[model samples]
Target: MSGVFIVSDNILSPIGLTTSKNFGQLKKSVSGIQKHHDTALSDQPFYAALFDQSGFIKDSDHKYTRFEQLLMASISDALQNSSVDAGDKKTVLIISSTKGNISLLETESYNPTIQKRISLPASAKLVAEYFGFINQPVVVSNACISGIMAILTGMRLIQSGQYENAVIAGADVISKFVLSGFQSFQAISPGPCKPFDVNRDGISLGEGAATIILSANPKNAQGIKVMGGAVSNDANHISAPSRTGAELCQAITKTLDNAHLLATDIDFISAHGTATIYNDEMEATAITLANLQTVPVNSLKGYYGHTLGAAGLIESIVSIHSLKENLVIPTLGFNETGTTNPLNICTDLLSGNFTNCLKTASGFGGCNAAVVFSKQ
Candidate 1:
C-alpha cells in the first residue's frame, strides 16, 4: 500500500467553536460541558457540550442543518491549515455521522410518534458542494465507531490509489432524540465523565465536528502520515464491551503489524475511554493486552463530551494536531484511575519530540478500530 499522509487537521469543539479558539482552549484544561437547560424532557440534567464559536456561515438566505454548519466550518479550517487545495480541487469528501436529522424529531406535544429521520447524507452532499469538493461519500455508520471508520476509509482510498486525496469529515449534535436514547440506555452521566475511572458513571452528549485532509504524499513536510489501520468486531455483545477485548486487541495488532511497528514504538495513545465502567475496564484490559502501558494514554471525551459518530474524526484531528504541536493534552476531569487493568489518564501534555502514535475506538454494533499515525 502507498503511504497516506495527514495533510491537515482541524477540530471545532464546544470548548472553542473554531480552530483558533479550540487550540486556545487546548493549551489550557478548559471543558465545554455543563448542565443543559434548553430541553424540558431531559430531567436527568445531562451535561451538554455546546460550541462557543459563531456559526461560520451567517446570512438570512444561508440555510443548513446544525450538523452541516459545524462540518463546513471545520473543513474550511482544516484546508486553511493545509497545503492541500480547499478552494478548487477534485477532492473527495467523506462524511460520517450517527443521528443526522434526529434533531428534527420534535415531540411538540405530550403525544405523537417519535419520527425516524435520516437527513445527514443529503446534508453532507450539500456541504461538500459548498466546500468546493467535486466528489463525496456519505457514510452514516449509525454505529458509534463510524466516525473513525470514515477517517480510515479516506486514508485507504488515498493510500490505494483509488483517490489522489480525500477529506474525512465527522460531525454530530445533541437533540431530544439522542438525549432520550441515551437516557433509555441510562448512559447519561449527571457528573463529569472520568474515562478509565473505577467510579465512572457514563457518557455526556455533545456537538462538534473535525475534518482531516489526506494526500497520497505529504502535503507539508510537517504533516503526519497514516501508516496503517485495522478494524474488527467482537460479535459478543450488542451494546456492552467484552471483557475478553479480543476483537479490540485484534484490530490493534493488525494495525501495528501492517505498519511494521511495535507497541513500544508508539509514543502515546488516544483512547476511546468513554468513562463508562464497562468501556473503561474493557479498554484498560485491551491496552495491557496490546502492551501499551509504557505509552501514556488520554481520552478526549472528558473534554468535548461524547460526540458519538463524530468522536473518532474529531479526536483524530486533535491527535494529528498534537503531533504538530508536540504536546498531548491531558484528559480533562480525569482524577482517579479505577480499572483493574493497567491504564493511565494522562494528567498533562508531556513535552518531547514524538513521532509514531496510536488511536483506538470501540462502539455499538460490536465495532472497534485502531489506527497508526506518524509524523513525517
Candidate 2:
C-alpha cells in the first residue's frame, strides 16, 4: 500500500495566504498578533490575529457564511496543482473546526432553522457541495486537536481503501462568542503571548484556515509522508489538561511507535504551546517524558496566535516547509525557558539537515494528539 502523502497544502492567515507565503513570513519572525479594540469582538481591547474584514473574500451568494468561505478558499488553493478530482467518487473531503457558523448565535437565539445553519455538519455539507465532492463530508470538531485529527482521519480512510484522495481543510474565525468565552476564563492575554516564557500569561486568539491534500499515490508527492499519528484523552478536566502530562506522553509514545521512530530519531518538535501557564508546563512535562527534552522545539502560536481548530494544521504545514527547507523557525515570543521540565526551545533561525519532525496538540476536552512527518 502506498503511504498517505501530502500532495499540496495552503494556509490562509493574517500573515499570508499560501503555505509558502506563511513560511516566508515565519522565516523573518513576523507576527500577525496585534492589539485590537473592535467593540464587535470585545468591550475592552484585546490582542488577536484577525483578517481584514474590508478585504475578506466575498461570494455573490450570501448563503455561505464566513466559516464556509474560508474552507472553500483554502480547499480551492490546495487543489490548484493537484489532480485530485473533488467530484470523483474515490475522493473525500474532511472539515475540521471548533466553531462553525457559531457567530450566527450572536444575533439570533437557538431555533430549529438557526440551529440547522449553525450545525457543523450542515456547514461541512455546504463546503463539500461547493467543491463538488461526491462523498459525504466528514467533520472533526475535537476542540484544538480537530485539525490533526482530521488529517489522521483522512490517512485512515485512505488506508482503509475507501478513498484515493482526501482533502482536509480546517478553519475557525474569531468572533464575539469566542472572545467572550475565553475572556470569561481570563485566558486572553493583554499583550502578545509569550509561549514557554516565565512571564507568559495567556493565549492570543487568532482566526485562519488551512488545507492539506492527502494522496495514496506517492509519485507526485512533495517528498514528505504523513508517517503516523495517535490521540489520547486524560479526561482530567473539561477545560484544563492533566497535571502530570502522563496522557500527552502516552500520545507521543504511541505516535512515535506507530511511525516506527524513537525519541532520538525526531529532529525537532512543533509543540502546542498555547502560552497559557498550565498548557506550557504540561506540554513540557510530556516532552520530557517522551525523552525529547534536547530536541529543538518551537511553537507557531506566537506568530499566528491560537487559531483553535486551525492551529494543528497551520503549525503542521509550517513544520512541513521547515523540513523541506532545512531551516527551523524560531519561537516568536519565547525569551526564557519557563516550563518545569525545560525544553530546547528554538530562539534563532537555524539551518540543519533533519528528516523527521513531531507536531503535538492538546485541547479543551483533556484531549492530546501527536503526529509525525518525515521527508520521503
Candidate 2 has its poorest 10 consecutive residues by lDDT at 53-62
Per-candidate TM equals: 0.92, 0.98
lDDT of 2 by residue, 1-376 (tens): 5698989999999999899889989988889999999998998999999987633456765778889888888889999968788998989999999998999999778899998999999999988988899899999999999999999999999988999899999999999999999999999888999999998999999999999999998775879999999999997998998999999999999999989999999999999999999999999999999999999999999999999989999999999999999999999889988999999999999799989999999999899999999999
Stretches > 4 Å off in candidate 1? 52-54, 86-90, 107-117, 140-142, 219-221
> Which candidate has the highest TM-score of all?
2
11 Cα displacement, candidate 1 (Å): 0.9
Q: Rate the local accuracy (lDDT) of all candidates.
A: 0.78, 0.93
Q: Could you give candidate 1's per-residue lDDT for residues 1-376 as a string of tens digits?
A: 7777777777788776565577668778788787766654476556878765556665356566677788888888887777776543546788888877566656333323323224555777678778777665547574778887887888777776778778888888777888899889988887878777667899987788888788885445356788888999999988999879888999999999988999889988999988888988888888888988768898988888888878988777777777777888898867777888767668887777888889999998788998988887
Clashes of 2: 0
Runs of candidate 2 with Cα error greater than 4 angstroms are 54-58
Worst 10 residues of 1 by lDDT: 108-117
Q: Model 2 — TM-score against the truth?
A: 0.98
